[model samples]
Target: MNTNKKAMMSAPNTDQNILKEENNNRIIHKKTDTLVYALGGLGEIGKNMYCFEHENEILIVDAGVHFPEENLLGVDYVIPDFGYLVKNNHKRKILVITHGHEDHIGGIPFLLKSVDIEAIYAPRFAVALINKKLEERRMLRGVKIIEINEGSRIKMEHFTVGFFNTVHSIPDSLGLLITTPNGRVVETGDFKFDLTPVGTNADYQIMAYIGQIGVTLLMSDSTNSGVEDFSISEKKVANAILEITKKATGRLIVATFASNVHRVQQILESAVASGRKVIVFGRSMENVVQIGRKLGNIKIGEEHFITADQLSHTPANKVCIVCTGSQGEPLAALSRIASGTHRFIKLIPGDTVVFSSSPIPGNGQSVNQVVNKLFKAGANVLTKSILNNLHTTGHASQEEQKLMLQLIKPKYFMPVHGEYKMLVQHRDTAIETGVAPENIFTCANGDVLLMRDEKVYQSSMRIPADDIYVDGNDISGVSTAVLKDRKILSDNGLVSVIISIDSRESKILCKPVIVSRGFVFIKDSQSLLKEAELIVYNALKERMKTRTTFSEIKNTIRSTLEPFLYNKTHRNPIVIPVILNSKAAMLQMQQQRALKNSNHKAASE
Candidate 1:
C-alpha cells in the first residue's frame, strides 16, 4: 500500500507538483506575522529607533540618542536599549537613516558596536556626517555603507523599501515606505511639509501615491503637533532677519542652529545685501559652512568665509558675524564674544546680536543668562520673543499634520518624536482624519508594535533606552537616576545627622552631629542647627523606645527631622541617619554622672 502511494504521488505531473509547492510557500508567507518595534525616540523626542519584523527577519530604522534634560548632569547622551533584539542577531538586516539630526543618528557608533549590521542606507550628507562620528569612535569596521538619494528603492527578502524626500531643516531628509508581502507601511522621519523649502519640498506626488496605494501603517512626526497652525518657513524668517540688519548700524551678529544651512544662507544673503562681509565664527558654524558648501547645499562666495583676524580689522558696519551658541552653551563662540573672552573678536557698544533660534524647553534659563551677558557687553540683543517671526520651528504644525494624515491615510498610526502630552495630541489629530480609534498607537521608547494583516498588537518589550554619561571622550552607563540625585542635591541642599544610641535600651547617647551643605552657613545658621539638633535628640529618644530595627529608627528620624528642619530652616535637606551599636562615649558620660553622684552623696554625709 505504501509503495503504491509513493508511486501515486510520483505519478503527479512535475509542473503541477512544483506549482503546488510554490503556492504553499506563498500562502505560508502571506499568513506569517509582521511586527514593528521601536528601539528609541517613540515616546520621547530624541533617541529615534524603529524596527520592522517580517518572516523572522528585522529591518531597523534610525538608531539615535536623546539629549539630557537640564538636571541630567554629567550625562553624555542617551542611546536606545537594544537588549530585546540581542537574541535575534541574525534577523538584523539593515540600519536605515532618515536624516542628519543628532537625535536620529547620534547613537550609530554605540549601536554598531552591538549589532552585526549588513549595510547602512542613508542620504549622502547624512552618511558623510555619520562617517565622521564613526571615525571618531574608531568602530567603523565591518560595516557596508550605502549612500542613497530621494526616490531610491531596495528590495530584500519578502520586502521592498523606498526613500521619499521630506523637507526638514537639514538637507536630504527622507521618509521611508516599507512594503511587506501583504501591505505597505509609511514612516515620516521627523518632517515638516514645507512647500517653499530651499531646494526640495515634501514629495506631494509620492505621498499621494502612498495614499492611493493604501498604507498599512503610518508613523509620522508629532514633535510640533500641539501648536495649531502651519510651521513658518525659513523664507519668512529670512525677511525678518534682513529687516533687522537694515536697521542696525553697528556690527551684526546672528546666532542660530549650526545645522540650519538654509537659515545660514539667508543670513549670508542679507549680509551681502547690506554691504557687509559675512565672517563666520564658532567651530560648529565653520564646520557647517565647509560641509554644506562642499556638498553644494550652500553656495557662498570665497570672500564670505573670512577669518576672525580679518573680522578684527574690518569696520563694525562691514562685518556680519554668523556664529553658534544660540542655546547659551558656555563654551560657544557667542558666549566668548559676549564675555569679551574671544581671542580676536569681542562685542562692544553699538553692536547688535540677533538670536535666530527659539529657546528649546529646559534651555530657557541658560538662554536668559546669555542674553544678560550680551546686554552687559553693551550689545543690543534680539531673540524670538522680541523679534517674533525671526525664527520658525522645523517641525510641522497642526494644519500640516492634518495634511500629512490625509495624504498618507495609513491603516495603523503611530505618533512619534514627542513627549507624552504631545504624543497624545498627535493621536487625536490622527483620529480627526478618520483613522479608526483601534488603529492608532501611541508608543514610548522600547515599546514594540506588531502589525499583521493591518491589525496592530503592542507589547512592552521596552528596549534598554539609557543615558551614557560622558566627560570629554569617556563613556559610562550611568542612568538618569544620577542626574535626578544631582538635581535634588542642587535644589534642596543636603544635611547629615549623627546621633549615638544605646542598642539594647534604645536611649540617646549624645547630641546629634549636624552638617549642612548648600543650605546655610554654619556660623550664620548656628541657632537653626542648635534647634534642629535638639529636635533630633528629642525624636531619637522618643522613637528609640518603640522602634526596634535600625531602618525603622532611621525612618522615624527622617520623618521627625525633615519636618523640624523644614520648619526651622525653611528648606528640606536630605536627611541621613547614622546609628551605632556600641556607644563607648555614652559609657564615658555615664561614668561622669556616677562620679558626680558619688561626690554629692559624700558631701551630704
Candidate 2:
C-alpha cells in the first residue's frame, strides 16, 4: 500500500483486520480511539496549535505564530507545519480561537491558505482582529468567521464544544470544554483569577459546574506556573497609572502591548481624568484603538484624540501620548522618540515615560538600552517594580494553577503553552492537587496520546510538526538552507569572484576580479586578494583545459578558493563565482577600440 494512501485511509471507518495489519507494519494505525496531539506549543513558548480527533471529525484549538528571535535572521513569524492538517483535510475540521492575541490567531491567514477549514469560531474581539488581518491580505472573501461568546455552545458531528469566560490581558478570552466520545477535555486558553480585573472576571461558577460533572483530561496554560503566588490584578495597574498621571507635571507617555486592550482603556481613562488630550502613535496601536472603540471595548470620546500637528499648540502638561514598544523593539514608536528620531515627537525635559509591560524573555537587554537612551534625554522612566506596580501578567501563577486544578479535578493532565521547565512545574502542581503521577504527561510537539475506554496512553505514532518559517509574503520559501546561508553571510560576509570567459572557444577572456564585502579590506589585504585572484585564475584555466562546462568551471573556482581563503583568514565567507559570457564583453571592447581608432584618424585628417 502507498504510504500516503494508507495514512489517509487510517480514519475511523477502516476494517479491524486492516487496522491490525497496518498497525504491525506501519507507524500510524487506524483506530476509533480519541486522538490528542500538538502540531506546536508543547515544549516552546509560542506557535500554539492543538488538535483533537475522533471518527470523521477534527477539532482544532488556537492557530498561532511564534515571533522569531534575533538569530532567526530575516524570518518574521514561525508557524506550524500544516502537513498533517492538509493530509487529513477529508475530515470535518473546525477551528476555535481562544482570543485575539497574535500568539493565538496570528497564523490564521497562513492556516487558511494551507488547509480546508470548514469554519472558524471566535469571540467578537478576535473576529474583528481576524477580519482586519484577512482584509489586509485580501483573503477575507469566502472565509467564514462566526462570533461566539461564553454562553455559546457548538455541536459538531463528534463533539460538543462550550466556552466559559476567562480573564486575561485581552477581553473576550474564553476556556473551552470539548466533549468527545471517550471523555470530556477542557482547555484553558490563557487565564488568571483576578478578583478585581479591569474587564469581566473569570466564570468560576461555570468552571465548578464543569468540574462537578467530570473532566477526563485538562490542558492548561503553564506560562506562569513557575511564579509564586497569584498574579496581580489589572485594576492595580490601572491605579498605578492613575497615580503616575496625577503626579507628573510634564507630558506623560505610556508604552504597552497593543493587544492589551484593558491597559489601553485604562490609559485613555486616566488621561481623561487628568484633563489631558490623547495622542496615539504606532500603526499597531492605532489599529487596536480603532478596533477596540468599534467593538465598544474602548469607550473614549472622539474629542480626546489630537494629531501630531496639534502638538505645537498643546501644553506639554496637558498632553498624554500612548504608543507601542513596551518590549523595546527598535522600530517601534516609543524607541524612535527615545532616540530623538521621531519626526513629530521627541523626549522633552521632565517627561515621564511609563513602561506599562515587562520585557519578554529575550528582550531585557533591548529594553534596558531603550531606557538608558530615554533617561539620557532628560526624561524619567518607570517600569514594573515593587515600588510601582505598572504592569501585570495575564498568566496564572502557581497558586492560581493549583486553584484551577482543584476546580477542574481532571483525571489526566497535560500542561500546554509554556517551556519544558514550566510544564514540568505545572505537572508537579497537578500532582499536589491529587492527580496521579502516571496520569500526567509532559510531551513535545508531534507526540500523540490516545484515549480509549476512558484510559489515556501514549502512542508510538508521530506526525510532522516542524517549524515553518514565514519570510515576507512567501510561506514555504525560507528553508533551513536559506537560513544557513543568511547566517553565514551575516557572520562571515560574502566574497564574489567574477570571471569573463569565452564559452565558444573554452578560453578565458580576462583575469578574475575578486570583490570582498565584510570579509577583509582589499587595500590593506592586497597580497591576500592578489593570491585569491591567482587561485581562481589557475582553477578556471585548469578546468577549461578539457572543454569543461560552465557549471564545472564555476564549481572548480569555488571549491579551490573556499579552502584557500578559509585557511588564510580563518573565516568561511560565502563564496560566489559569477561566470559571465565573454561574447558581449568582447563585442563591446571591439566597438570601443574601433571608435577610438576612428577618432584618431579624424584628428590626423
Candidate 3:
C-alpha cells in the first residue's frame, strides 16, 4: 500500500473515535468463530505473525520482521500492518513467542509500540531476549512478559495455550498447542526431528498425545519442505566443528548466527578441547554469550576467555575467535575483518576461517566476496559444502514434515512459514500422510480461515496484511512511490536548470544555468549542455508570454528538455527547473543601498 493509505489506516484517532470503533468491532465480532490468518510469513520467509480470534479474545503468535531485499533501498526492515490489531484493541489480546530467533522476536518492539498488549508469554530465553530489546528501546515499562516452559499452561477467556519442547538450533525452542472452543490448533514453530539434539529432544510423547486428543487445525513450519531427506542433527555439526578445530594448525576464527546458542556452545566446547583461549567478537555475539552463561546454557569457564589486549601476547595457534556475520553482512564483525578494517583483529598467514553456518538464500554472492577477500589475504576459508560438514539447518525437511503431520493428525493442515513453493511442497507432504487434498489450505498472507464446529472454512473476508516498510524510525514515510523515485535517481541521476526572471514585467534577467550530477560530464558535453540550456530558455520565454504560473514555467522547461536530452544521450535523468524571482532580488538590493547611504551620511556627520 502507498504511504497515504498506511498513514490513514495507522494514524491515532481521538479517544471518542477509538472507543466508538472498538465498540462497533465488539458488536460486529460477537458471532465470529475461531478465525485464523497471518499478517506476515506466508508467501515469504522471515517475518512471522499469526492471529487466532474467537469472540473478543485474540491470541497472537510471533511478532517478527523480514529483512529487506536488495531492491528495497533505504529500508531497514519490513513489518506487518497492525491495522487489524489496532481496530480490535478493546479485546483481550495476548502475544505468545515461540523462540529467541530474530525473525520470531525482532518485531516485538514495534508491535508493542503499535498495540496495547495485555501480556506476552514466552520461554525463558525468549523472555530475556525480549526484555533486552525492550530495554534498548526504553519501552520496558508497563509491559509484562511471563516466562513459560514445556509444562506451563495458560488459560485465557477463550483459549488454553500450552507448550511442547522442539529441537531447533537454539535452546528453549518450543511448539504451541492452543485449544479453542471449536477445537485444538497446533503451531509447530520452526522445528526439526533430531534424535540427538544439542539442547533438548523433541517431545514426541506430547505430540502424539495431542494427536490422540485430535486437532482441528495445524499450522506447521514449511521452510525446508522441498528437501527430500531429514535435516542433519546439531550433534553431528558439533562433532564436525570439533574435528575442524583439532585439525587446524593455526589460529581459528568461526562465524555463525548469534541466536544459535547451541552452535555457540559447541564452538566454545571445541575451543576448550583444543586448549585454545576464546575471544568473542560482535555485539550480538557477546550479548548472546553473556545471556547463555547467565542462564547456564553455555558451560564454558571464564578462564578460557581472553581480551583483545591479550591476543598479541597469546600464541597465534592457541587463540580461537567466535564472531557473527556468517551471512556476510557488510557491517558484521567477520566482514570487517575480511576487508582488513577491523579495529582489533587482522587476518594473517595460517589463519583458518570457518563459516560454521550456511549462507542465507540471498547472501551467496556476499559470502563469496568475503571468501575471495580472505583467500587474497593469505587466510584459509572453509564453508558449508559437500566436502565440509560444518553446518546444519534448524528447519525440518520433507520426511520430518511428514512425521509432524502424522503425529499431529490435524483435521485441516495449513503450512505457515516459508515461500510459496515450499508451502506447496509441505501441502504435498501432508497429502502423502493421509491428509485429504481438500483439507489442506495453502494460503497467502491475508487469507482467512474460519473453524466452526470443528470444521475449517475459507472466508471471503480478509484483513490488512500489506508490508509496512520501516525506514529508520518512521513507519509510514517510505512508500512504493518513494522507492520508485529512489530507483530512478540511482539509475538515471539528476539534472538541474536555474533561471532568473522579473515577475512584474515577465522578463528574463539572465541566461539559464545547467548543472548535472551523474547525468553527464559537463566539461566534455559542453555542446550538448549548451543546447539544453537554449531549450529551457526558449520554453520559459514561450510559457511566460501567456501569463504563466511558476509551475507552468517549470513544466514547460521539463517537457521541452526531456525529449531533447533523451534523443541526444538516450537517458532519462530527473530534470529539475529552478526559478529565481528577480523582482525580490532588486528590492533587497535597493534596501541594502539605502541603508549603506544612510550609514555613510551618519559617519560623515
Candidate 3 lDDT: 0.90
- Estimate every model's Cα lDDT from 0 to 1: 0.80, 0.91, 0.90
Select the stronger candidate by TM-score from 2 and 3: 2
- Report the number of the highest-lDDT candidate: 2
Model 2 misplaced stretches (Cα beyond 4 Å):
1-30, 584-605
User: Which digits, one per residue and each the tens of the lDDT, describe model 3 over residues 1-605?
Assistant: 96645654685784322322332232122274788999999989988999999988999999999999989988998999888898999999999999989889998888888798999999999998999989988999999999999999999999999999999988889999999888899999999999988888999999999999999999999999889998888888999999989888999999999988999999999999999999999999999999999999999989999999999889988999999989989999999999999999999999999999887889999999999999999998998888867989999999999999999999999998999999999999999999999888999988988777787777666888999889987766489988987787888888998999887677788889999999888889999999889888887887778676778888888899899989998889898889898868679768899999999999999
Q: Which clashing pairs does model 3 show?
A: none
Overall local distance difference test of candidate 1: 0.80
The alpha-carbon RMSD values of the candidates against the true structure, listed in the order shown, are 11.4, 8.0, 9.0
Worst 10 residues of 1 by lDDT: 20-29
Candidate ordering by lDDT (highest first)? 2, 3, 1
lDDT by residue for model 1 (475-515), tens: 44665566666776888888888877776566777888888
Cα lDDT tens digits, model 2, 1-605, are 88855765765663322333453454343466899999889888888999999988889999999999999999999999999999998999999999999999999999999899999999999999999999999999999899999999999978999999999999899999999888999999999999998898899999999999999999999999899999888989999999999899999999999999999999999999999999999999999999999989999999999998998799999999999999989999999998999989978889999999999999999999999999999999999988988999999999999999999999999999999999999999999999999899999999988876666776778888999999987777489999999999999999999998886688898999999999998889999999999988987888888787767987898799999999999999999989888767568768899999999999999
